[model samples]
Target: MRSLFKTVLDQTKPVVDEGPRPDDKEAGIVSDDKEAANVSSERPPSSDGDDDSINKDAQPGVQKMEAITKVWSTRDLYLAYFLIWLIYFVDAIQQGMGTILTPYVTSAFQEHSLTATIGVASGIIGGISKLPLAKLIDIWGRPQGYLLTMCCMILGLVLMAASNNVNTYAAAQIFYWVGYNGISYTTTVFIADTSALRNRGLVLAYTSSPYIVTVWITGPLAQSVLNGVGWRWGFGIFAIVTPIVCLPLYFLFAWNERKAVKQGVLVRQKSTRTAWQSINHYFWEFDIICVLLLSAGFTLFLLPFSIFSVQKYGWRDPTTISLIVVGFVLLVFSAFWEKYWAPVKFLPWELLKDRTVCGACVLAAVLFIEYYIWTSYFTSFLQVVLRLEVWQTSYIANIYSIGSCLFSIPVGLAIRHTGRFKWVALYFGVPVTILAIGLLIQFRHEGTNIGWIIFVEIIYAFAGGACVICDQVAIMAAASHQEVAVVIAIEGLFSSIGGGIGGTVAGAIWTGVFPQKLKEYLPAETQDQWATIYGDLTAQISYPVGSATHAAIVAAYDDALRNMFIAATTITIVALVAVTFWRDIKLKDFKQVKGNVI
Candidate 1:
């Protein structure tokens, strides 16, 4: 572990600045560099104080935005990291339980078919929020962002426990994900702020280590909640426990911020702009309008597919047609806005052109698309087909995350050892992903062995660990120290988008095809109950294993999952191709982004 987590301050003398050579741009390869150096060192400065970070134009929050730049002792970081991991630990259990109850929560409204739509809603909302959250932490500082996002998380959990309809549940999911992803984004930024460039991926990968411990416990924990208090309490308990766990971390950041202020390390700079001017300034700065346009466009366009299945008018559904049309228009408008008239660009044109950065972005998007497409409703499938207990189903379902978390340890070590990430991703990640998807496709058949399903999941998890850590490293590599934090915020944006699209597609398939498949597979007498079974997991799993109804339900599930896996498999192949676009940048050092007050 020590080999994996290199000492941050061990080599304090600045890394020799070997900036990318000219041909590196032409090759889209780093040459002596590893990947994306497309990032500019320019940054929006702190409006609050006279600070010495580069790019002094007045804009957002802290100078150099380095929380640890001149802050307190090594003891402070050690305590802060302890508190950070503690938050991660509670967060793991909270999020894990929340995921377990999502399907049931939707089913309470008899809208289980719309389950994926919830993810679509949440992922899109959650995904786009990362940039804004990043901007927020930039402007307001880390502790403030921490408190704000945590509040959102608690609110979402409370609402989830009390939600009575799909609408409320969906909205809660969006809020929850926004906060969830925000917390994740902030922590990653914090890690970058603290760790050296070379060790960034190593530490970032370590963040997922909690999942390794939590994975083994989440299954039994979820099962106990389900059997004892039912699913509502499952979500409710997290809301109650999370604050107790997270508030200490908040106090740590807040107190350190105060100390930094008292010590003159950070001084608040007062803005002279009027309220409206400040609003307008930030409006363009954060690129909110563009985000809204893209979010609306993406949501409207993809959402109709699933809702289309539920609407009685089908192809003639005016609402569905109108949404798709409006969505298309918005999408086009967003493209032109981004290209021509937007005040601030969300991603710079050069970065967009960088194959390494683009490759990483594309990988994030497609990986999520492939994952959400198949995994939504998977728990329901497991319980029905494999006749597994709630705990048993959870263990199987969580294999991917557990495997990824565990594998990340080695992948992190390798990056630390070789100072390279490309070969690991290209050689190990892609092949394993393909194999996992192929196995998934094979196992979706009825009467398939459950072990094969779990096997594929473990493999998928391994791929996720390898691919994810590498892509993130690739993204940050392209950034100058100045632009690194910005890149971190937007890193998961495409993933969120991909997840949203994938979930929508999943809903479309399940709602449109699963019921039909249910009709096709179920016996004549059991036919009318297909709707009931589709809406209720308990109903699906209630019948005797060998009985006609039970077999029919399992067959219907197998059929639906088959389509999902087929779609997921196709997307996985695209990810394999997409990954090739990344230059094989070796992980050598963190961006020292010149011009800061360091």
Candidate 2:
């Protein structure tokens, strides 16, 4: 089997038909004294005039703009990009539907403790499921693994649509988890294959831009639909379309799978391994420590946020909150255990130690937390403070997606050309943090215009979106070539953890502060009714509250939003400081240097 593996790799290794030639002027090798000098020096020497032109082309401004145009015009790349985006869109719709239908699900199964725990169970199980799936991608080719996962998602959605009880719904989440991991790995592997070293950064950026966009765009529609009809239909709609649309597209644009076999991308092919074999042989050589650290860090970070809504405070019940706290502690312990005791670490220890990589992780985590808080709880602010309708809220959310789309390509180009990512981080990230914080502080005031809100969000989105691209480039630069996939997986895991934590934190803060703020604003009689409506803002905020209670409810919502924003701002500042200290490693010369930052 080992011999066969070696044979396959030898046969597939790319060969350059054009071979070496004469050191002096000779046939087939346009060689001269200077050319000979270039070979000896290990640098491509150029004439003085060519050097001048090259210098001009490499200028920060000119090259940045050129890279931007090249990325924009690369239509062939968009096929894979669009497919992944569409799949994410479907996932986004599902997420929105879950939020929108929370009220209905609560009402339908309120009596059953098991039923009430269904959604929570689904999230935890799904997260745990991803680790094994990650291993599978390392073993099986990414494309085939991804196709199989899509099938799993489609099947899960079908089951979810048919489910009437909480148990089945929980099962659906597990299945959906399997599918999501598959598609994500597929898209990642595909992009890596199709893109060249020169444009790799842009390819990654192009693929990821849609991640935030799809959810925001589809979330509101799902919310609107849930309000108009029932939530079951939302899942049903996806189940019907998954096979018809997403599945076929997965195969049609399945470029990654074919390329893997053709080139033998990984060192070993599974055809030589036993059917029952594990993927240990194909594991990333040195990224284990970082992966473990990130995964654990996120698990710890996620727990407190996940149970924010259910935790107890001064006046609230402590039962759920205590349980959540315990869960969070367990997650922390797990991280520690993985960091200290895991026999085979999944994270790269050295990379984590690198100032640049560490700083990038902190920056990405902080920025993501801000993004999540705004995303998860902004709807509450819209409904509770401004009294917007569900449809109206959805309409406004589109601004964020639009903003991200507008900024993504430009940011990708800037990093590719200038190789000056730290400046880009400062330029875009600082303003976004400021706007987000300012909006929160001013939100509780008298002159909160809708147009102003829209304007701020657009500005925030543009800056934030650009910062994301810049940060990803930095992260890629901070790792070695062999660690690229592992580092990306680490990034994805941490980013998701940041979002999860932010969501939970916002929920916790909102729930903790809501009652006290309500006491200050609403009449006792109105408070209980408002609490139920608050659970689903799209259902209740747009309608008029009586003159008596309106001011108070609005003020309370603003106060809660203000606190969350302040928290977000503080984290962003920490992230910025972290970025300032990062060791700037230029990635444009990756081909020349066999490894990246470390």
Candidate 3:
């Protein structure tokens, strides 16, 4: 066995260096001599106490070692960037499909509350998976980690396509979400690895800009599929296409790692320990128990709000109460464990102590909470209340994505040029977001202008795009190179918590208030049909446009949606307050930044 393994390794090793040799001075390649000269000339003199350590860490042989630790040549870097862009383009299409899938999936169940509840559950699963996946990417190398995510997504797509019940559908969602979040987390980390701080925002924006085209294409395509073929085909098709689109990039990554290993830029470490010992080591290093505790705590605490209204005794039910209480207790235990007991901490508590990171987290959480509060049932409202066709609703609903895509590149360029994100967040992002939310509240009524609604969505999208980009840059600037992926994962966790809470709260409001309002506005004679209308959305829109029942149902929808908009606006105000605390740290190269000080 050893001889066979050795033969395979020897064959895979490169026969010669891929770049210019160390002694080739005329080639302009970054050899050992040129690297030292460049470091000395390009790096600014150390002004702070941490500069010496930063300089030492930047030395060629002293960089934090990993399975693939080599810095790429300029040509290779650009090639990697192009490959990443293609990967994100495919990813965006899948996301666009997902946006339409929510309504289709829940419509199968014929329940209003299920939509938001399912979203909360999915968010919880996705959120909890980020930390482990981040660790995996850091430890296992990006190629292996990315392949694992793809496998999960493919399996999930198969499950969803074949699902015959809501339980199966939900299980499929859990797997897909885990893969989606992992992909997103790792992609961002890869971009960070390739680009410096000065150009990071622009690179990220360019990579993400494919969302614009994908949103435009997939929104109509998804609707066409739902209208003609079926939602199952949608999932199955993407499952087949994603691997085909992404496999080339995967092979390229593997090739790069092999070349780096052969070139001596990466050192291969062989493990001598037994298999059982290796498993034990990884389990502790990944802090599996803490992951479980956190996941369970979040799931239990947040899922109840999504279902409490439908429960027999509502909030007073024993199971509901116990779930919340026990969930909170376990959350507290997890916090203490990370702070005091864990041998290897998954969440960098010390980093969280930084003012910028803390503020960014709080702001991001609040923003996501606000965003989801109204969005949880937006497509349903357009379908049931406005009586729009699937295609029409999809076009309008995805305007947010279109607007975001349009503005992201510009915002990224502006931040890159200015080297500042705080002012942009405060003066532009916050006020515009609040204005958009307010406009939505005012215009979200029966007989309101559709054009105005579309405009509001655009405004919100542009502002949200700016805020999200700025927030990401700020957080990245605050973190060191080694911690970039983990910090981003932590930010994702906050967003997930916010999404879970928002979805749960929105579900409660939707399930609790919409039905009561409908009963009040609906005539007593038609009240007997309430169950039919509530159970099946199609039944709600079956009434004629100008009829009493139709008007009453529309009014109920308008009222409930108005309340949701107000809640979102109020929450965003809190986010604005959090943004005020964000410090304006200059976007310096990570190698130059010192000790969590920013």
Q: What C-alpha lDDT do the candidate models reach, one value each?
A: 0.74, 0.53, 0.72
Among residues 3 or more apart in sequence or in different chains, the pairs in candidate 3 whose N, CA or C atoms overlap within 3 Å are none
lDDT of 3: 0.72
For residues 1-598, could you state the per-residue lDDT of candidate 1 as single tens digits? 3432334224222232233344333323343442246423322111122232433442234343453345555666666666677788788887787777777777778887787888887889788888777777777777778788888988888888888888988888888888888888887777665655556666766677778778778889887877789877888888898789878877877777677678776666777999999999989988888889978888889899887877778757999999999999998998899889987886566665666777788888888888888888788888888888878888888887789888876787688777778788888897788778877777776677887888788889999999998888878776655455577766689889999988988888888888887888899898878888888877887898899988778777877888898898888777777777666654442234321111
**lDDT for each residue of candidate 2 in 1-598, tens digit (9 for 90 to 100):** 2342233223222221121223322111112344443333222211112111112322221222122222322333344455665666666556555554544454454311122233333333344334444444444434455667788888888877777765677678658755765566556644543443335455555555544545455656666566666677777788787766566555543443343335443122225765445345444332354444444444444444334444444324465545546655666665785677766565556667656667777777677677656555565566556666655766566566657655766676666576456777775666566666567566544347888878777787787777776666666555533344455555555555555566566666766676567667776667666654445443344446656566666777667777877777676777778777554444443331110100
TM-scores, each model vs. reference: 0.89, 0.71, 0.86
Q: Which candidate tops TM-score? A: 1
- Which one is best on lDDT? 1
Q: Residue 178 in candidate 2 has what lDDT?
A: 54
How many Å off is the CA of 409 in candidate 3? 1.2
What is the lDDT for 155 in model 3? 81
Over all chains combined, what TM-score does candidate 2 have? 0.71
Candidates 1 and 2 compared: the better one by TM-score is 1
